[model samples]
Target: MNFLGFFNITTVALALMFIGSIGMLVVKKPIDKVILYSIVDAGFLLAVVTFKYLDVAFAIAILGPVSTIIFLMSILKIDRIRHNNREGGPNV
Candidate 1:
C-alpha cells in the first residue's frame, strides 16, 4: 500500500483509541466503560496490524475479546452483588 493509505489507516486507528479513552473517562456506567475498552483494544489491534506486526496483531485478536469477556463478567458479578444487597437477597 502507498504511504498515504497507511497514514490514513493509522490516523483512523489513533482516532478510535482517543475516542474510546475519552468515552471511558466520561461514561458513568460500567458497561459503557467495558464497551469503550473494547473499542480501544480494536484500535490498538488495527495500529499493530498497520505497522505490519502480524504476530502481535494475531495475539491481540485472540486475547482482546477474552479480556473483554473477563471485564464484562466482573461487571455482571458486581452488579448482581449490588442488587442482592439492595434487595436483601440471600448471600451467594
Candidate 2:
C-alpha cells in the first residue's frame, strides 16, 4: 500500500477508537460498555496491522477475544449474584 493509503487507514482506526471510547464513557449498560471496548480494541488491531506491526497485532488479537470473554463472564457472574441476593436464595 502507498503511504497515503496507510496513513488513511491508521487515521480511520484511531478515529474509530476515539469514538468507541466516547461511547463507552456515555453508556451505562455493562453489555454496551463491553461492545464499545471491543470496538476500540479492534481499532487498535487495525492500526497495528496497517503499520506492519505483526507481533503486536498477533498479541493484541489474542488479547481481544480473551478480554471480551472475561468481561462477559464477569458480567454474568455479577448478574447471577444480584439475582440470587434479590431472591434470598443460596443457589440450591
User: lDDT: which candidate is best?
Assistant: 1
Q: Tens digit of lDDT per residue, candidate 1, span 55-86? A: 99999999888999999999999999999999
Q: State in Å the error of residue 27, model 1.
A: 0.7
Once fitted onto the true fold, the runs of candidate 1 whose alpha carbons sit more than 4 angstroms away are 1-7, 89-91
Q: After superposition, how far is residue 64 of candidate 1 from its true place, in Å?
A: 1.2
lDDT of 2: 0.90
Q: Give candidate 1's error at residue 17 in angstroms.
A: 0.6
lDDT of 1 at 53: 100
Off by over 4 Å in 2: 1-7, 89-92
lDDT (Cα) of model 1: 0.92
Q: Model 2, 1-92: lDDT tens per residue? A: 56775568878899989999999999989899998998899898999999999999999998889889999999888888889999998852
Against the true structure, candidate 1 reaches a TM-score of: 0.82
The C-alpha TM-scores of every prediction are: 0.82, 0.77
